[model samples]
Target: MATVLPEGTANNTAERTFDSLNPATDEVVGTYPITTPAEVDAAVARAHDAARFWDELGFAGRAQRLRKWKSIITRRLPELCALVRAETGKPEGDAQLEIVLAIEHIEWAAKHAKKILGPQRRSPGLLLANNAASVEYHPLGVVGAIGPWNYPVYTPLGSITYALAAGNAVVFKPSEHTPGVGKWLVDTFAEAVPEQPVLQLITGFGETGAALAASDVDKIAFTGSAATGKKVMATAAQRLTPVVIEGGGKDAVLVDADADLDAAADATVWGACANAGQTCAGVERAYVHEKVYDDFVAKVVEKVGTVRGGSDMDAQYGPMTMRSQIDVIRRHVEDALERGGKAVYGGLDSIGERTVQPIVLVDVPEDAAAVREETFGPTVTIAKVRDMDEAVARANASTYGLGSAVFTRGKGVDIARRLRTGATSINAPLSFAGIASLPFGGHGDSGFGRIHGPEGLREFARPKAIARQRFSPPLSLTSFSRTKATEKLVARMMRVLHGRSR
Candidate 1:
């Protein structure tokens, strides 16, 4: 019943719109409006008005509404997951997993916002003993969230739910490739809090996203490529608006000599190929100790042997949501082979018009694109290292340090701590993202700012510090009426308190 146009296409007789297609079938799944710059600005204006009402609903009231929305999503999980599958071309199981994670985040943000953002007393210290101080987080007026197509539901909601829980209104701009999923989330949220447009949606291509970044929103939370993230930052700089950019990662997995060969292999295969390797933090590189390198590669190659990517129901994963990625995957794999890498499993022929078969290349040069770039596809490059030190060194050499996993018995946490990544899973791949209490983000080119946990709630709010004079100070330092004697006393006291460390 609904119709739309492609990106940048204009309609002579009606409002401009675009169609979202099923990546697997190449069939139109749904259509959404091609929201223009004017519409994005108007949406931001509405969010500012709604922000006051939403913020006034204190933590308790906001939590109640958020829980209702959570319940709605949980009860209709299957229906929403089905829509996600159709729109994103991920398998139904993968789609369900994404929704389940999103629901968990919503519940966590609702329950913890008060404890994390409410007013808290602070010690004034000896220098200001007469003053009582406290700090509370106040919501930013409005947040602009630009989401990615991969893991569309879970990823965007990370920003959306936390911002709402922090008492800020949100304007979400989902990737054009998955507009239907974005619309579904906003529509359902409205049903829960019909009183205000607390969460709104804007759909289109890059132009729409650029407009959002350049809008009057208080902050921008973006998840996409590093190059694109730079553009968003440049645009937001025009207004000097703050932003959180989760650029993609060339994440790595470190396999130690004492690690469980089988388990490490299994984690590597799944981490590298899951959701057709569309994940931003997916494992793109593996550095295994020379002692266990051969065994780990053997097990991983065996595990990948059973993996399949296609439109069939039995397939392990679905087609590439963005078709352009297929060529990128092909190029990376070919480049690795040309540079003397050996394909332990699939190779150049594994890349297809739609889906990519699991490809495992061993002995790939560290400087190869397959190892250095964020190849968002079902591929991984494995290299042998002399020891855990070398493995850690190679893993930390990447310019993008979003996520990493370290597999070892006694040194799991130690190795994890040594790696320079936003979050590291000690024994499991991407385990940090599943923990609702842990803040998830990255360093270096993978982008900055955080989502999830208390840090996430604080990301969308500003800390307002408060101080009150409860009594007269022992030293009247504020007054110049008796400064000569007071100054001498103050200098003596400062030396006594700060000149030496206890």
Candidate 2:
């Protein structure tokens, strides 16, 4: 039987209840507080009230407190990882790695927020020469985030940390499957800053998330399916609220003929099987050079066969966190086989109730759903291409352009640049996610906006431009006293500067 928590409570009272189950055993882990529309409104109101104090604290004071929060999280890393592992049913080591990355982002954002967000002088155009100008980033009063179940800690923290450091109060609504992890993060923030509620949590089902989207928050940061993102944006449009979406991806990895097969195989195995292949940036498709295709597929299949998925201590993969996802994984596999794709390793029988064994496919059609759509499972489709150009072309054919990787000897960086994705790894798989200095986001259907580095800090804050008159210009165009000669001079200057004939 499933456990059910109360629908309404002092911490978070609402009119709905949802169950969070342990995927490994198909048992109820715990029930979370389901927030109603009224509760979501109250949370947003409190965040707005708290943001006034938080925004006034200035970047230095905010950084100091954020540093304290980082320390608390770093010291309790093991404890936090345990919660992550239990809630998401992922390996403990994987959980630790994710937490460490989250810490790195938090530390980076805290240290760099002042420099990236502080006011800086701007050069007013020559047309407005008499004016002194400056631009500064201002916080968007309250930020709402709706996170996913995969990599629950790192994914949400990407937005939560940056928004907080940018001087905005955050009202986060984590996936219902991982509410405990969300509660722990919010509680930790409370420990760091007891004076005000800089971060708050509102838990519930889709209705609750919908309420958050409709609430009066200045911005919404969402990470989930593209379909859901569209709905969130549509709802937010009701209030003319802005949004930053980090949606799904059918990412690819390209292997050149001159690439190291060993490294490519290892990356393909880990990328497709880790977290039971529930990663947004996981390798769902691979376009390898025809000359090296056979060798690469053999090695990847051998490595994948040795891996296991269960609650066992030695298991490399874990059960699917969301039970409903099992059907989706199964459907993709069946569809692939039905469309004349050959599975080199596991077949349709590999998908279980909670755990999905690794499936490696070769000779799959590019148009097959398994290859074209976002499987988001531990299944990868490998195709043979003529050369690097074909590999790049096939990789770029996908609708989702989140992250892609290339394994080669000489032209890895150059090829990475050619791929039309947000971030690219030269010889590594998903290393861009760990580098706090590099911006992390995507373009096209993968989504817009950024979540890491300087771009991320700016995303959370709006630009405030100030211009003051310092001295009278040679020709004052703003007033009616401007002469025709001055206008003629302006036209000549424009022609000389911008309209010059090539």
Candidate 3:
């Protein structure tokens, strides 16, 4: 694959370089610099300075620039999608879907940020009605975003676009395995606004990410495994720099007895296997009502059989993006079978050279890793539950509450609301991700903070409240000339307005 980075970023020494390999073919995709600490700091320093200019542009100017950037990505989507497929081993169609959603978010942020973060008048309450109060969200200066390999473009852009719309420069640290995709985005951003380095890329390993986490940036946004997120938070804590952590999740799908079994099964398979199941909100476990568990399992098995994984266009999915994750997938599947679970579909032998055939385990122990932890592979565990209540209970039992889905003819929304996840969809598969107007994030081990919609605009900004005196009050509460009689009058007024009835 061709390099996406600018000229100066290429490394000259082998030790200082890291190669991104096509997971399906195990071929070198491209090599990127193992950005040093100094390089990371320099990039942040540049973004820090650029933030002043970006912030000065105000919402209107920044939104226009962001829209330009969004247009460029939309126009060159084919090229971007191909690069995503090359680096992440995802199919071009899947890659396109991700970029398409990302572009939509950029558009939404550009169009709505000004309205969402602009100054708004507010009541000063009964005690201060004479004063005029208003509040506006100000940019938090430079923002450092560490991206994940899965859905790299779309996921990172969730924060990057909102930050830019809120008028903050961004220093992005793309996953080392997908640096080229990151570079493409930053380079295209530079094209939109040629005069400024508002968005910069620093491609490297964990050390580079660590430096950025502790840099002078006003805030950090990280998306990755829960363990790494903790380390990032710790590093940022040294300077009391705030962070938005989008951590890992072991999401589940709850199927109700009254639900449409065929639709539910189809959605479940897609949610479990799409993008090789590396999605943070991907469904790794399914809880089906006992009345329809057998039928649902049959549909899932039939649908799964139609899907295959490879580097070819005919394949439904691609290989695991991270080579090491192959073992994790194997371990989870094997452990499930060893712990008395029966494979309703693909089994241990389904694991191949670089691809893992869709594996569906039924009756897997509730405590099994296949059901408890994030497998991050094209595998899922199906269990029969007594009722919707049982399904909800089991789903909520997970410690990672990132995303969830419920399939029910009647109680879909009710069950979805009961789910302890950050985002839950009713009778649909990961629908929340496609909606740009909704905020996305997780709770507990899934991490905190939102990225999208009104909440997202404020996430990258600090609200500044202003209270201006409109007219002089009858009594000068702040003046020493205030008489005891006036103070007593004020006390009487307070008692009348807020005192409890006797």
lDDT of 1 by residue, 200-305 (tens): 9999877788889899999999998888888899889889999998999999999889999888999999999999999999999999999988888889988999
Q: For model 3, how does the per-residue alpha-carbon lDDT over 345-454 read when each residue is reduced to its tens digit?
A: 98988998689999999989999999888999999899999998898899989879999999988888789888999899888999998999999999988999999989
Clashing pairs in 2: none
2 versus 3: better TM-score goes to: 3
How many times do residue backbones clash in model 3? 0
Pairs in clash, predicted candidate 1 = 5-17, 5-18
Q: How do these models rank on TM-score, best leading?
A: 1, 3, 2
How would you encode candidate 2's per-residue C-alpha lDDT over 329-360 as one tens digit per residue? Answer: 88888888888989999988898878889999
Top of the candidates by TM-score: 1
Q: Give me the candidate number with maximum lDDT.
A: 1
Stretches of candidate 3 off by over 4 Å are 1-15, 500-502
TM-score against native, each model: 0.97, 0.95, 0.96
Instruction: Assess each prediction's global lDDT (C-alpha) against the native.
Output: 0.90, 0.88, 0.89
Candidate 1 local lDDT, residue 495: 97
Q: In candidate 3, list every pair of residues with a backbone clash.
A: none
